[model samples]
Target chain A: MTSAEATAHYFKKAARIMDVGERIETLLAAPLREVKVQVSIELDNGEIRTFDGYRVQHDNSRGPMKGGLRYHPEVDSDEVLSLASLMTWKTAVVNLPFGGAKGGIRVDPIGLSSKELERLTRKFVDQIQDIIGPTRDIPAPDVNTNPQVMAWIMDQYSKYHGHSPAVVTGKPIDLYGSRGREAATGRGLLYIAREIARDVGLPVKGTRFAVQGFGNVGSHAARLVHEDGGIIVAVSDVNGGVKNPKGLDVPALFDHARKTGSVKGFGGGVPCGSEELLTCDCDVLIPAALGSVLTRSVAAEVRAKIILEGANAPCTPEADEVFEKKGVLVVPDILANAGGVTVSYFEWVQNLQHVTWDEDRVNTELEKLMREAYERVANISRTRKLPLRTSAYVLAIGRVGKATVLRGI
Target chain B: MLDQLMKLPMCKGLSQGEATELASIARESQAKKGTVLFAQGAHGDSILVVLEGQIEVSMSGQTLAQVGEGSVLGEMSLLGEGGKRTATATVLSDARLLEIDAARFQELLKTSHLAALKVVANLAQVMSKRLLAMNEKLIEGNKGKKEELADFQKILSNWSF
Candidate 1:
């Protein structure tokens, strides 16, 4: 199934459990607005290129829409819509005062020069500037995007609105970006994993972990978990995977990866396939890569006790069922990866107030928020006898549902 | 005061003797908190450098920038041909400021070509950074309005023919 179909499948399951009426279900499922624009720019080689760009505003009953703008070849209306809906649940899961939106340009950024990329970003902003604002829809960084990209968006938006830094988050610190935002997703995953490890009677000191991706989230989670005495036995990236049963030296591996551009040839570990890294024997498995990797077939062979989803839609519904049958706990993406958005919210607050916060304040606030959300989800899971994913959805769907009803729509 | 003046980017790269000469031309003045050093659109004659305390750059009562020690203020007016202050400078705290008139600025430029070149280069860098930031913003504002107009034209095209 497509990503949107998968999102709808999970939404249907949660709605059924909540016994939501058909009318409300339909209303909640449909997006509020879908915008498609042609973003054309001149390449440095004097050639003109055009890209299809999309901004899907899924829901805004709770507050202003908030999401990311990615620059990737796979970005389309379907993916944007699915992600926008996920943002709705994610913000609600964390209980932030925001709704949901997602936008992206369907172009591979690797081929474009820095100047061309800036031009494209500015052009995309031009197309959607009317629909986005600090109090309308705020965009953050996503796949193939970073602080520099956010800085561009903020600078671009400020020109129109007279220095409105809150129009976008994840900007450079020099340009009103928040501290601790870069490590937020991975750090959040660590916080939630710690809570789960504690509840399961597994101490972090000796638990083995195999992370499926070594990007920002995986790297940060591995380093933090290692610092907490967790052994990261295996890790992978797009280039390849590496494994060391005695636990690889995370700092050395990080340096090696940085220099060599992959974890394949690190001296501390033997090279392994990406699939082997996923199904490796470990106490915890984190899928911080792309979505749908944990299909039913892959899930059936999994050896991990707990799965922390650090990427969006990393597990299919079929995989969720397989894990359920196998009695493995799955922490849903909405809860696991909500850290990035949570910190984004803090950055937006700081910008709107014309103040900057220290890194310590950002990290402390993140831990408090993540832990509180985990506790609330855990409480519902125990009292309702539901899986963590279901409980998270229950908590989120209830909030959105109540807001939708109270607003008379 | 010379040490602080040397720390400013516009005064960097100057030799100790050159810095001392530049500092000699500057008149140090004290301003209490809530002092308005200059108002927006006032005739600009001198550029002020902060040696201690904070100054707020504001327009129409909205604070645009907060500058502290080793910061050069009102340089844009000195650089601009029109010689009009773009923003009002208000003291946020009791401040020590070094003010250099246009005549003294020219004297330093004539006395040492090296110091003058460094100052002009630094000023260019500062102005370019501000221009780039404002350019990004202006592109957003202008392009957004233009895109809306294009969208209107597209709809009108559909109905016209």
Candidate 2:
């Protein structure tokens, strides 16, 4: 299943656990509003192509909707609705003043030139410009979209009003992007693992960590865990993974992946497939790449004590059940990788105030939020006698429900 | 005819329970003149009958017709497979509406025989008028697009030769 669909599966499971009233169920069944606009763009080929772009504002009960805008041929309103709903739970778990929104165009962005992509992005923004703002709905990056895409969205939105950089996030650092934003998810995983280790009376130093994926999230997580004196015995990427029982040179592996764009053929470690990375023996197994990597089949082979989801919806509902049975501590993605949105929130604030924070301040503030949220989730897990994922969902759902009732929505 | 439909002719053999259900479904909403009530591509769930004032029904933002009190909008969008709002409904003046969800309204048809005939007949008449207008626009739009693409392809063929 795709990550978006996997996310929906997890959401259904979480909803069942929450066992909320019918009112909330009815509210969450479908988006509050789904906007489909004809985004007519004059392509570089001098042909006008009208793309069907959609913005599914899933819910704004807790606050204004916030999520990423994916640009891909497979992006549809249903997928957007799913992702947007996940965002609602995610932001609520992280205690952010936002709900959920997902917007995207049905186009293969890879085929388009930079200029063509720019035109398409601007036109898509123009079509839905009426309902979106910094406070209403904020758009960030997702599959086939990046900082450059966000910059274009912000620029187009600014034209209609003024220099409203806060209208979007996930821009380049030069454009007021947060410090440590790229590695925020990985960094948050390390913090969560450390906090868990401390709670269990295990020394953080020499703790074994197996990270699956060497992209922005995985590589940074490996580095951070390694820096914390943790032994990263295994790491993987799309090409393949590497392992060393003693401890692989994480910095070297990161550099090699950076140079080669894959973890295959790296010296001093054995190669393995993406699936094998999940089952590798380690204290903490971090799935930092794509979603649904940890299905029930692969999860049964996992030997780890904790599974920190660095990637959104990396573990399927079936896999999560297996983890529960195995007494594995499964930290849900919302609570684990919330550092990105937390810093994105900071960036939005900086843009609104026309001031930028130093990298040190940004990292410090992000770390503070991550640590505190980890403690809250951990405490809830202990008090409720539930899994960390369940506790996190409970806390998030309760917060959003209270906010909805307060707003009288 | 429009005003009488809004009043719903309760004296004409309409039962008390049926009248109550109809009134319960009726809701009031305010819109400034020229403000669109339902836009094209919107998920249309309700069929609205204007109780007061008038509205303009437009396809792709161009006015197709004007609908006044007791005139219903969006019956086809509700019953169609996609359930999309095919045309925009803009309030020409302040409007009060008795709107019913298409599904509930359909269910009501199964329960109340008298309501069913009136609703089905009214829906058929509204759809027929809309289809005729839509056919004219489709014919006009198709000719221009074909000629434009044909001219472009001809230029490309000549360049290749």
Candidate 3:
């Protein structure tokens, strides 16, 4: 399925359970605005290259829209729109005071030089600066974009809107980024895993964990799980994967990845391909990398008793059905990977107040919000006899639906 | 006498002899294009049947419909108590018209029971169709207002503030 269809699949499933009717479903699902602009930039080589950039302000009923800015070759209007609506649900699921919006450029960031990338970012900011502000749609880091990219966006956006640190989150710490924002998604996964293990009787101290995609989300998730005494049996990145049934050394793997730029050369365990790592020998499987990795076929081969989706839309609808039949507990991405946006919200709040929160305070506040959101969804899942993903979606859609209705939409 | 003038809208179920008897009383007349056969709110006591050419029905100077042969004009004035035209009728081209006075038709109904009953039934059916069309227009206009009021009720029930 296309990413848009997959996200809508989950939305419709929950909307059906809520019985919100087709009219409200259409209103809630439709984005408020879908904007696409040509970002023409003069490259460092003096060649003028124009790129397609999109920003979908999905909903702003609760508050201003908030989401990430992704820089990838596969970025298109459909994926951006899907991600934007997903943000709407994610923020509502977490009970944040913001709605959802997402932006992306269809050019691979890796292919551009530093100068070219900066010019592209500035031009993109110039194209959309009028629509985005601290109180409007705020952009964060996603996919190939990082703190440097966010910093550039902030600097360029400031040229038009003036010094507005709250306009963009996930910048360098010196440039107003939050301290815990870097590891928020992974840390949120840790908190949720603890809660699930406590209920399922699989203690975090000994639960075997396999994480696919050891990037910003996967690596931190693995390390945090390892620190909690969970066995990190397998982990993978885009380049390669590593596996050890006895548990790979998480810190050593991090070192190896930092030096060699991949997990392929890690000496702690057997080298595995990224695809095989999904069905790795572990009790808990975390697909924190790309979306749609867990299809019907993959779910059939998956032996993991619990699946934590630290990536957005890692499991397709068919895979979800397969897992349902097999009784695999799936912690959805809106709740699992929502830590980043949750912390980005913190950063935005801090920027708005002209203050910086300490790392400990940031982590504590994040844990509190994460726990509350999980408890709400878990209670509905247990009582309603619905899947956790559906439960979370139902809760999210209910909140957003209420907001839209109450606000006179 | 124009045979087509016997085909008045209110004479739908009348027999050939009955229609010819009614047409025998209609005084034939001719008017040029753009002539006002009847006007909105004007009192009338006769129903005119168009035998040939087109006539335009309008309201407040806006043309509502362009009608041709076999069309009836001012039928409502004969049936309604006020005997006032609801809309204006203007001749679109030089045409034939058969004007039947209301008092003469009333006198004919006294002697012809079956023909009067059939004509009254046909007029009632036409009047009912126009009534239904107006009802539909009323509903269409109120749709937005209904939706807005629904949203208000929902909020009033569920909204705390």
Query: Which predicted model would earn the best TM-score?
Result: 3
Regions more than 4 Å wrong, model 2:
A1-18, B1-161
Predictions in order: lDDT = 0.87, 0.78, 0.88
* Candidate 2 per-residue lDDT over residues A268-343, each given as its tens digit: 7888777887888788889988878888999899999888899988888888889999998888998988877777
Which residue pairs does candidate 2 place in steric collision? none
* TM-score for each candidate, following the candidate numbering: 0.71, 0.70, 0.79
Error of 2 at A260 (Å): 1.7
Per-residue accuracy of model 1 over A1-409 as CA lDDT, tens digit each: 7556787788888767766556557888899999999999999999999999999999998899999999999898988998999999999999889999999999999999999999999999989999999999999998898889888888887778788889999889888888998889999999998899889999888999999889889989999899989999999999998999899999999999999998888899899788888899899999999888999999999999999999888888999999999999999999999999999999999988988899899989999999999998998889768899988887877777767755764
Q: Report chain B TM per candidate.
A: 0.80, 0.60, 0.80
Candidate 1 per-residue lDDT, tens place, B1-161, comes to 87888888888788998787776777999999999999998988888999899999999889899999888887754453537788999999999999987666776566665666687778888889999999999999999756643543343233221
**TM-score of candidate 3's chain B against its reference?**
0.80
Q: Each predicted complex: what DockQ?
A: 0.00, 0.01, 0.08
Weakest lDDT window of 10 consecutive positions for candidate 1 chain B: B152-161
Which lDDT tens digits does candidate 3 get at residues B33-101? 889988898888888888888999999989899988888877765554536788999998999888888
